[model samples]
Target: MNVRSQIKDYIAAQPEPKQKDLQELHGLILGIMPDCKLWFLDGKDESGRVVSNPNIGYGVQVIKYADGKNKDFYQIGMSANTTGISIYIMGIKDKKYLAEKFGKKIGQASVTGYCIKFRTLKNIDVGVLEDAMRYGIEQTRV
Candidate 1:
């Protein structure tokens, strides 16, 4: 199945995920972007090891950053755990931009020189996030 389908299936499989939370997040993405394609990364890095401590299924990917030939411009990933939901801005090269924009909440973001990690989706401004995502579609050139 495709990433978005996989995500839908995964979330549906969860017995007790707060329905409103799931719907709200899903709605946020759909509302902010109607055309993003999704992908699944299976929680393993290129080396084949789980990236999170407790293994949160897989990373949710959004392909809004794809190039003209349909190559991925960038991948945005997300996962939820006991702590909270994380918004992973996968593969960002511009730290200055992110830091300036998100520093107010994400604090000092740990950079992969690629991924920008947020502990909680609620911490940052949704509009700023949307703006960044839009920038990904426009200037990022991934």
Candidate 2:
């Protein structure tokens, strides 16, 4: 259906605890960027195979490729995995910036180039995650 409906359905389809966490993250992201554009990716390729988990996205960021192509994508995204959840913060230049700045501070989460993954909300610091998300969103404006 719609983006919001798709997002809710995605979250609702998750198993226990994960479903709760996904719902919380969905609300948190909306609270941070209430006016942002919402998005939903079913994690399917051209063949429609499930290559990855479904993602709920927020905000808009234009991605410029070296081949002189550009596309609009979400500035931030959240997804539920088999083990836990993943939050993707796009538009960062430095690959190590997120890990260096927020890796340790975010608790038991894994901070990669543009992703912060954790088992649950209690395993990580929500404030630090918010800071990273805010940074990602601000970076897109520059």
Candidate 3:
């Protein structure tokens, strides 16, 4: 169906605790970007093979490739993984900023260059996550 419907279905299909957690995160992201464009990726390639986990996306930005090609993509993305949830802050040029900036303050989360992952929201500081997302949006805005 539509992007919102697809996102709702995807979140609803998750198992308990994850379903609830995803919903909460979806709400939080919407609050942070109330007017942003919504996106849903089923993680299928052009041939429809499952290459990655499904993703929920917000906002839009241009992704530049090393080959000089550029693509329009979402600024922020979230997904439920086997062990935890993943939040991706796309379009950042630096690969070490997230870890260096919020590594120690984000609690038990893994803060990589463009991703923050944790087992649960309770295991990390939501405020720090919020801050990171805010910075991501500001930095990646089209």
User: Each model's TM-score?
Assistant: 0.57, 0.96, 0.96
Tell me the spans in candidate 3 whose CA falls farther than 4 Å from its real position.
66-68
**Which candidate model has the greater TM-score, 1 or 2?**
2
Ranking by TM-score: 2, 3, 1
The sequence of per-residue lDDT tens digits that candidate 3 reaches over residues 1-142 is 9999999999999998988889999999999999999999999999999999999999999888899999989989999999989999987778898898888999999888999999999999999999999999999887
Give candidate 1 misplaced runs (Cα > 4 Å): 13-19, 45-74, 105-123
Please give the RMSD of candidate 1 to the true structure.
Answer: 6.1
- Model 2 lDDT tens row, 1-142: 9988898788888998999988888888899999999999999999999898889889998999999999999999999887899999999999999999999899999999999999999999999999999999999862
lDDT for every model? 0.51, 0.92, 0.93
Worst 10 residues of 3 by lDDT: 91-100
Instruction: Report clash pairs, candidate 1.
Output: 65-73, 66-73, 91-114, 92-114
Residue pairs with clashing backbones, model 2: none
Error of 3 at 80 (Å): 0.4
